[model samples]
Target: MRKIMTNKTSKYILLLICSMSLLSCEKFLDKQPNDMLNLDQVFSIRLETERYLANVYSYIPDPLVCNGVNYTPLSDEADWVFNWPHQQINTGNWSPVNTPYDIWSKYYKGIRAASTFINRVSECKECDELNPGITVQYREEARVLRAFYYFLLIRQYGPVTILPDVPLAIDAPLSEMQLPRNSYDECVDFIVSELDKAQQVLPDKQSNTREYGRTSAGMARALKARVLLYAASPLWNGNTDYADFKNKDGKQLVNQVYDQNKWRKAAEAAKSVIDKMPEGLYKKNGTDGKFDPFLSYQYVFLDRWNTEVIWARPMTGDAVRWERCSAPRQINGYIGLGPSQQLVDEYEMENGMSPFTAASTTANPVINPASGYTETGFSTTATKFTKAGIHNMYVGREPRFYATVGFNGMDWVYKGADGKTIIRVELFSTGKDGYNGSNDHSTTGYTTVKYVHPESDVRNGRHVLKSWIFFRLAEFYLNYAEALNEYDPQNPDIYKYINLIRERGGIPSLPEGLNQDQIRERIRHERRIELALEEHRFWDVKRWKIAEQTDAAPIYGMNVTTGTSFSDQNFYKRKITESRTFQKKHFLWPVPQYEIERNTELVQNPEW
Candidate 1:
C-alpha cells in the first residue's frame, strides 16, 4: 500500500450534513467560508474521489491483525493465551447483545461510500474532463467493492439488506428507510451480477504503479469464486432449518431446494480465475531446477504483489505489533500466537500421506506412522537439508510444515548482527520458549513461524513486513477442485487442480482410485494446511457445516518436560490446552441486538 495507495492522513470520514440557505437576503453572518469539502469538491477531482474509495478499501480487514483470540484462536487452527472474547465465541458463550466480531456497521459504511461514489462520480464534470475513461473504471471498482462489502455482511450475518444507490435520506419517514433484509439467494444473485458487470469494465491488471493494490478484473473474479463457493456450500445450500424464514413480502430467506448446478457454477468461476488469469502459485526456482515449496509458501506473504497474489493489503506499521506478539519467547517475543497440535497433525508427510494414525500420544497424534514420523524425542542426527538438528516430531514432514511450524529442537533461521544463522528451537517447559509462566510462553509449545520473516529482530524490535494476500492463485485452484469434486467427482480437472496445489506444496499429487468423498476431505485438508491462519479456517469449517465436529474437538498442545535423556525429561507430552464448544446455531453469527432494536423491519437469523 505504501508504493502508491495514499492513506488520507486525517480524512477519517465523510459526514452527511445538509443545509438550506433560502431567503436570507438581510442576514449577514460569518460563515468562516466553510472550508469543509463537500461532495461536489470531492467528485470534481479524480484523486479525491479515489480517496473516498481508498477509505472503502481500508474497510477490507487485514488478516494479520489477530485481536484477542480473534483469528487463529477462534478456529481450531491454533491457541494463544486464550482471550476471553475468543473463549466466549469458541465455547458458544456469545450472543447478539454481546457480539464478538460485529462488522455490520463497518461494512455498511463501505457500501455507503461505494454507493455514493458510483452514484455521484458520473455527475462530476471535471473528473471526466481530466481522467477521460478512467472514471468509468473507478465507478466499476466502487460497484465491485460495494458488492464485496455486501458479501462480507451476508457471510456472517446470513443475509443483509442490499442498500440501493442512495441510502434513504435521514429526514425521510422510517417506513421509507427501514428496509427488510433480502433473501440469501437474492444477495448471492446481486453479488454475482455486480461482479459480472465489474468484470466487463475492470482492467485485467491495474497497469500503473499507483494502482498496485487497486481492484482489478482478476479480483472481481476471485471474489466471485469465493461468493459462489459459499453459495454452493451446505450452509447456504437448501438448509431446511430456515424453511419457515422469510422477508416481509413472504419471500423465503434461505433457498428451499438444493441446486446441483451451484457447484458447477462455482467450479467455472474458480476455473476462470485460474485458466484466464496470469496468476499462479508463487514459485522460487532452485539452483537444481525445481520449485522450493517452503520458500515459495513463506515468501507468498513476504513478497509484495508477487505472481500468485490476486489481491493484497499492506500491513503498514501494524506489522510490528504482529511480529512482537507472534514471535517466540526466546527472541523476546510473546510467542502469543501458537499453532495447535491439531493443526500440526493435519499436515501430511512429505510423501503426501496423512499421519492420523501414527505412533504418537493420543492427545496429539501424528499421522502416517509408516514414514517413521515420531514425537519420540530430539533427532539423533542433523538433517542434511537444514544442516541443523531437528526433533523427530519436526522431521519427515512436508516443506509447508517446516515453513509454518517452529517446534522444539527445530532449526530457527534468524538474522542477527552478523548474518543469517541457524539455531535449534528449545520449547521445553523450562526451556527458552517453554511453558513456565504464560506471559510470553507458547501455550501450545509451538510458534507460528509462517509469517515471521527471517530478518525480523524481535529483541531489537525490527520487523520484516510485506503485503497480506486476500486471494491467491492456489486458492482458486483449490476452490475449483473442491467444487468440482462435489459436482463432477469423476472430472479429471478435480484431481488436476488439487494436485497443482499439492505439487506446489512439495506433496505428491493424487494418483487415482480416490472417490468423491475422499477427494472432498482431501480438498478440505489441503485448504486447512495451505491456507492456515489466513482467516479462512474459521469461516471454512463453519461454511462446510463441520464446525460442530471440528471446532468442538479440544484444542491440544505439547506439555514439554525436559529430563535426563531425549526420551526422559525432554519427552514432550500432549496436553489438552482447552476444551471448545460448537453448536448448529453457532454456524451463523447472530445479528447485533442493537441493529434489530434500531430497525423493526430487520429479521434476526434463526435461534437468535
Candidate 2:
C-alpha cells in the first residue's frame, strides 16, 4: 500500500504549467506560458526533460488503498485479499466510485501530462528538440504512456475515447468538446497504432539496467496483445454484456459486432513479445534437486529488478513500508484483507483438478482422515462443515499460497521490542507465545506475509523497495495461450503455453485431444490462480462479460470469532451476499457525475 508521487516541487511546477494557460488568451491553443521560459529554455536542460518524463510515473496507488487495506468492493472478487468488513459486502456494487475510478483518474492525469509534453516538446526549437533521435524516442514514450492509459480505460469502461492530444480546456463544456466513444475495434486499432509507433523508437528492455522499469518494445507488444485478447473474449465477442455503448446524456456513441479474429490479432501480438523479451521468472529458494519453475510470486512484486517484471512503478520514501499496513489488526493495526475461500479453491490441487470437480480420490478423501469433521469434506463440507473443509485443501495446493497468505497456527516472526528476532505463534493453538485472540492486537489471523522483510532486516521501513509490476513475462505467455485457443483451432501450440504455467504450479498437464473450448477454460483457470489478487481478475471478469458467471455468485467469507478458537471448526463457512452484476446502465461508469456537469462536452456513461 504505497503511494508514489512526483517530487512536490515538480508537481507545483506542473500546476503552474496548467495554471498559466488560464491567464493567457482563451484562444491560445498552442501558446507557451509566460512565467516559464519558452520550450527552448526548458528543453535545453537535460535533467528538465527527464524530470518531465519521470512525472508520468508519479501516479500510483494511495497507501490507504494498496493491498494493505481493502476498502474497494472489487477486492471481494479476485484482484485483492479482503477480510472482516470487506468480506461482508456486495462485491457486484463495485461502481465508478470504487478503487477502479481512482486508478482510472490517476492514469488519465498521466496521459494528459504526456500528451501535453509530447505536443510541446515536438514543437520546441532547442537543440534537444532538433535531435530527431532522442525526440522520436521521447515522443514514443509519451504515446506508449497514452496507450497504457487507453488500455486501462477500455478494459474498465469497454469503449472510451482515444484522445491523442490534450484537451484545450481543463473545464471545457460538453457541447464544445463533444466526442463520441470510439468503437472497441477502433480503440484497439488506436492502441495498436500507438504501440507500433512506440516500438519504432523504444529501446529493447535489455539495453539499460537503470531504467529497468521503463516501458520497452516488449511491454508495448505485450500490452497490445492483452488489449486484443480482451476484445476477443467470449464476453465481448459472443456475450451480450457489451453490445452497446451509451453516453451521459443517454446518447449512443458507436456500436459494432464483436469479432473472433481479434483473438488472432491478440495471439500474434503476444507472440511478438514472447519472441523478443529477455526476461524470465524469478526463481525460489529450494533445497532438493527438483527445479521449481515457480518461485515465490511475491518476488516479482517485492523485488524491483526481478526479471519477470516488464514495466513497474517503484515505491520509495514512506511508501517503502508495507509490514504494519499489511499485517493483521491483532498485531496492533487495522485487519488486513484476507484471501477469500473463493480464490483458495480456484488454485487446482497438485493433480490439476478442482476439488469440486475431482473424482473421489482415495488418498485425499472428502472426509478428514483425522477426527476433526463429521461428513465428506468436499461437497458435503460446504453444507455441513466444521473444521477446515478438506485437509488436502490446505495440503500441497501450491507453494505460492504459503508464501502469500499467513494461515492458521503459523509462526509470526519479527524483531520484538528488545531488538531481537522473536517468533510469535499466530494461530489458535498456544506454544511459545500465548495465543492472542483479540482482533485488535492479533486478527493477524492470516496476516499477509508476502511483502514483509526477513527477520534479520526488521528495521521500521526495511521492506523491499521493488517496483510495482504492471505486466510480467508469464502473463504474456498466458495471454498467448488464451488468444490462440480462442482464435486458432488448427494450432497445437496453445496447450504448450498453458502447460508451462501448469507445470510450474505443480498441477498435472492437460489430457490429450481436448477441444479448443476445453483448452480455453483451462487457460482461464490458470490465469485466475496464477494472477490472483494482482489487480487482474476484476478487469478479466468485466472484459469477458463473465461478471455474471464470476460475479453472480454471492461472495462468502470465513466467520472467525474473537476469543473463540476455530482450530476444530470450519471457521470460513459463512454466506455473505446473494449475487452481483453490472446493471445495463452500470456497464461504463458514468463519466463521474461532477465531470458531466462541469464539462458540457463530456458525456456520462449510460446510467449513473
Candidate 3:
C-alpha cells in the first residue's frame, strides 16, 4: 500500500543521523536518498516533505512477502514447499545474530525518519503554502506512523528505547545516544498516547483513491487496539518468565504484575474502533449467485477497499512476486506455501463443532466420522455433495475449509479451454500438485488457495494487483471479544462478537451453557479460522505463551506415498512433515547480536 511520491526538483533530502551508540549506525532504509541539501531545502516544500514520509511508509513490511521469513511458515499454520529463510527458526535453530526477520534495524531506521519529520516538519512554512488545510494532517501521519513502528518494534523484540519527540542530531555524540531500553509499560503508554493524539488530526477515513492507504483515524485506533491487546496478553502482563529480565540499569523490561485494567483498556479501545465501523463485518451477497461464505471471505481479500478493510497496501499491475511465492507448482508456480494439517484441523465442521473430538496424536486423529468425514474412496455425481466426483474427506466440511485448502480430487475451476471449467486436482502420487519430483509441490497435501485469486491465470503469468490488508473491522470485533472476556470472565458480549464472525462463515453460533473458558476456547478457534495465514496466528501463539505446546510438535500432512492411484488412495492417514522445537525462551525474540555487540550498554534478551 506504499506509493512513494517523487519530485523532479529533488535538490536534496534530509538524512537524519542514525541513533548514537544504541542504534546500529548501519544505513537502513533509503536513509540517504538526498544528502547534500540543507535542512531548509529538504523540509521547506510540500513535495519534498511528502516524499520523505512516503519513503518512511515504504519500510512497512507486507505479510506475504518473504524477507528472512515467510509469516505462515514461521508458525504452526503452514509448511513451505520450497526452502524458506525461516527454516532455521521453524526448526528452533536461530540465535540473536541469526533471526528469521530482523526488525531491530528496520524499525529503528523508520523511527529515525519519523522523529526527524516531527522535529523539522513545523519549520517548513512553504509546505503550508501549498495546502494549508492538509499540513497538520501530514505531520500527524508521520507521528502516528512513528508510534506504529515503535509498536512493531516492541512486539518483535521485547523492550526498546522510546524515541517520542526528540530526533537524533546528525552530529550528536555517540555517548548521548546509547540510551537504555524503556520498560514495557513506558512503551505502551507512549504508543497509546501518540495514537490518541493522531486521531485528532488524521481524517476519519481514506477520502478517495488519491488518499488510499494513507494514515487515518481508523488506522490509528485500530493499531492502538492491537498494541493494547498485546500489552494485556499473558506474555507481557504478569509474565514471570521474564520477571528476572532487566536492562543493564537494573530496570525490568517486562511488567511481571498482572493488571486487569490492561485488559479493560484494550477492550475499550477495541470497542471504540468497532463502534465506528458502520458496515460491521462484510457479507458476501451483492454478486448474482447463491450467498456463499467462501466467496465472501475470498473477495474480502480480492476486492480491495471493501467494507471490511481499514488499512491496506494497494498495488498496480500484476502481483508477480506474490503469485510466484504462493501458487501451486502444477500451475507453473513456486508452490512455496502449504497449509499444515495442524491448521487444516482447526476448521471445524459446518455445525460449528470441532473436527477432532480428541486428536491426542496426529497419526490417529479422532475426527468425527459421524459428520460425513470419509477418508478413502470416491463418490458419484448423483451423490448429494459439492465434491460429487471427489474424495469424501474434502467434502461437506466448513466453507472456509473449501475456500482455503486445495486438496486432492478437489474441483479447482478456473478459466480453461473455451470457457470457465473445473479441473479436478489430481494429487494422487503421479498427479499434479502432490507428486514429489523435479518441481516443488505442496508438502502438506494442500496448497493455500485462500489468497490466490481463482481468476488469476498462473500459466500465462496473468495476475491482478491485490492489496495487502493491514487492518479490517472483523479483527477489531475479535480483539474486543478477547479483551472483554479477559477483563470480565462472565461477560456475555464476548459470545456475541465471536459468533458474529462465525455466522459470516456459515457456521452455527456458539451454543449456550458455556463458561468463560469455553467461550475463550471458541474465540481462539474462530480467530485461527477467521484470521488464518493473515499473520496473526504466529503472534497469537507466542503472546498466549502456548508456543511450547503448538510450535514444538511435529507438523503433519496426508500419507502421499500411500495414495498411488485415484481409485484406491489413502487420504486420512497422517504423515509427519517436519518436527519443530520451541522453548519458553522463545516467548521473546533476541535483540540481534550485532546490536548487542555494537553497544555493550544494551542488555541481551534472557537466555540468548
Per-residue lDDT of candidate 1, residues 1-608 (tens digit)? 11122234111111110001111211211221133788788777655665565555656666566552246688888887746477778777888999887888889888987888888878666545654565677688788879888998888888789887686666988778788998898899999999998888887665553345667888999999999999999989988878877876787899979999999999999989998765567888666787788788878878777888887765545556666777766667777778888888888878877766635444745456566677665565666344344557767788898778877766676777677766665677666666664567677778887777888777676666566678888888899999998898889988888888888888898868987887887888899999987888988987788888888888888774442322443346678777888877787888899999888888888787
Worst 10-residue lDDT window, candidate 3: 13-22
- The candidate maximizing TM-score is 3
Counting clashing residue pairs in each candidate, in order, gives 8, 23, 1
Kindly list the per-residue Cα lDDT of model 3 for residues 1-608, writing each as its tens digit. 21232332121222111111112223432453356776678887665666676666766666645333446788888888666666787788899878867788888898888888877787678765554544566678888889889988888877888864787676988877777888888999999999999898777786554456677888999999999999999989999988788987789888878999999999999999998987788778745766778788878888868888888765423234566556655566665577888888778777676657764356677767565565666676633226566766665678888777777766665554455556666565666665554357767777777767767677676665577788999898899999998898787888888888888888888898888787787878888999988889989998888889988888898766556655655644678888888887777789999888776678888888
TM-score of predicted structure 3: 0.91
* Candidate 2: segments with Cα more than 4 A from true spot: 1-41, 60-105, 123-132, 164-176, 238-255, 278-280, 285-290, 293-298, 318-321, 329-335, 358-392, 413-447, 452-459, 570-584
Clash list (residue pairs), candidate 1: 355-366, 355-367, 355-368, 356-367, 561-569, 562-569, 563-569, 563-570
- Please give the distance, in angstroms, between residue 7's alpha carbon in candidate 1 and its true position after superposition: 19
Per-residue accuracy of model 2 over 1-608 as CA lDDT, tens digit each: 11122243232223212211222212322333333655465555544554465565444333323543333345333323334333333344444344234444667687887787777655434424334345556667677877887887776566666664754575875455556566666787888888887887676563434344456676787788788777787645655443344455555444446677778888898888777754445555646755653444646566655766776654443443356544543444333444555665555544455555433322223532332322222322321111233333455445556555655544455555555553443344231111343333222234455555444233343444445556787888899888777778658778787776666655678789988777767777778777766667766766665665555555554434322342445443433422444445544444555444544555555455
| TM-score, structure 1 vs. true | 0.90
Q: Against the true structure, candidate 2 has what lDDT?
A: 0.55
Ranking by TM-score: 3, 1, 2
